[model samples]
Target: MKNVTFYLDFVSPYAYLAFHALPQALEGCSYRMEYRPIVLGAVFKANAVPSPAQQPAKRDWIRRHTTWLAEQAGLTSFAPAVNHPFSSIPLSRMALACSEDGAINRYVANAVFAHCWEAGGADPLDLQRLEALRAVLHKQWQPTIQSVDDEAIKQRLRANTDAALATGLFGVPSFVVDGELLWGLDALPMLRARLLG
Candidate 1:
């Protein structure tokens, strides 16, 4: 199977879009997705770039684009996040905490995105949100709350972000397949073709 490395941040609406789109795109392809959590802020800082939300027009555009894409993708359940560019630090840590040897890690990651992304401006790290995340993981896998604060998890996420930048990833929803970088949710078809042909 072709291996696809998914670089994701829960705060990214595009990443949320890819959460639903890529699976459909690669339905028949022989591929394995390896999900990793990275700090988008770290990526921006490493590149000395400002986040799109920092600009008024770009922020507005993202709002519209994500909403429209969600509808086109038949994901009407998705709404443009009202509070974008929210701090993803805690959510990233939760993803790292969810990491394991099997697919439940992906479940935990997606659950975090599902829980927080739709609310727009919702605080993902609030006590209530944290407990909700805990519930999601605990439902299937036993996750220690301390895992979020583990030094190994911290280093792991930091390394993931650095590795992503090394691969020329400048944004979320990036797929690195066989050393090829495909950026954005719109790049799903390219990834699908790579897996198919």
Candidate 2:
């Protein structure tokens, strides 16, 4: 069977970490991750919990904490988005569109991760970046903000977030395997184990 579905957002550091860890953790496992972009902010609002970036102290701690987690996990450098808490709608919309594009979603995911995590994303969800990504993915995207403002794209993004909640997701980088939900990068080892079993 193919891999479990991974729900994520560019605004989430944990999601960034998970993208790096999953391949190794699931090595030799006959499963592939189906990536779905969802706005973590919407998930937070649904759960009645503010995103970590919404609070100064929590945002500061997430930076420090993920750095330490990265070191322990022997993963890449954890560069928190220079533009923490930027609206992820544009990125999310592009991802939703890529979902229907064969194999283009992989490139889209990589581009989003690189921009929001490693590259010091001082401008989150910048429309130009989305347009560029759309071009590379061979999708049609207007250069203006209207590119992502289409009602269908907006609804698709909203539906993705709603699907995440229906699966009991409370955060980004969550894996849904056979109806069992695993949240966060820390769950990778457990995910590997479950995949084996």
Candidate 3:
């Protein structure tokens, strides 16, 4: 069986959009989707990729386009939070920990995106919200959240981000298969085609 690795950051609205579309997109492929949580900030730094919000014109364009895309996809709305240079390290670390426990960790990922993008929560680093998310997951791994501050775990997160960047990934919601890189939720169709073929 073939497999595709999905690299995502919870801070990206595009990643949220991809999550909602991926199941349908990969329906006919004999491929397993592996989710890899990565640090978006680290990747941006390493690749010198600028955020849309940093450029006034691009920010406006993305806001309009993202909202329209979200509506077309039947999503509520698309408004990423106001945190300049979003901090998703804690959330990404938690996702890695969740993966270790044999769970998809979509619950936490969705919650983080929803809180930051849909709910317009300024602080994506809210510990209280993260705790609530953990409760909803029925996970007793209190140390997972705390592990974000651990040097070893932080190093792993950085390494993962570096690996992702090395793949020539310039954005979030990237899917890699057989060294081919597909970027954006819209590229899911192309990914599906490659996988099926």
Predicted structure 3: lDDT = 0.72
Tens digit of per-residue lDDT, candidate 3, span 1-197: 67788888877777888988887778867987777778777677777877765688987676677778888888876666666346777777666555543223456666656766776545666678777655654473444445546665666676667778899998889989999999998898899889878
* Cα lDDT tens digits for candidate 2, 1-197: 64698888878888888888877788988886778888788788889997788799998888898878777877574567666877777777765555542122566787777767765445655667655666765553333335556776777777777888999899978999999999888899989888988
lDDT of 1 by residue, 103-134 (tens): 22567777888877655556666788788787
Predicted structure with the largest TM-score when compared to the true one: 1
How much is the lDDT of residue 111 in candidate 2?
74
For candidate 2, the per-residue lDDT at 112 reads: 71
Per-candidate total of colliding backbone pairs: 3, 1, 0
Cα-based RMSD of the predictions, in order?
Answer: 2.3, 3.4, 2.8
Better of 1 and 3 by lDDT: 1
Error of 3 at 154 (Å): 1.2
Name the candidate that leads on lDDT: 1
| Clash count (model 3, backbone only) | 0
Worst 10 residues of 3 by lDDT: 97-106
- lDDT of all predictions: 0.78, 0.75, 0.72
Error of model 1, residue 188, in angstroms: 0.9
Any runs in candidate 1 off by more than 4 Å, and if so which? 101-104, 139-147
Ordered list by TM-score, greatest first = 1, 2, 3
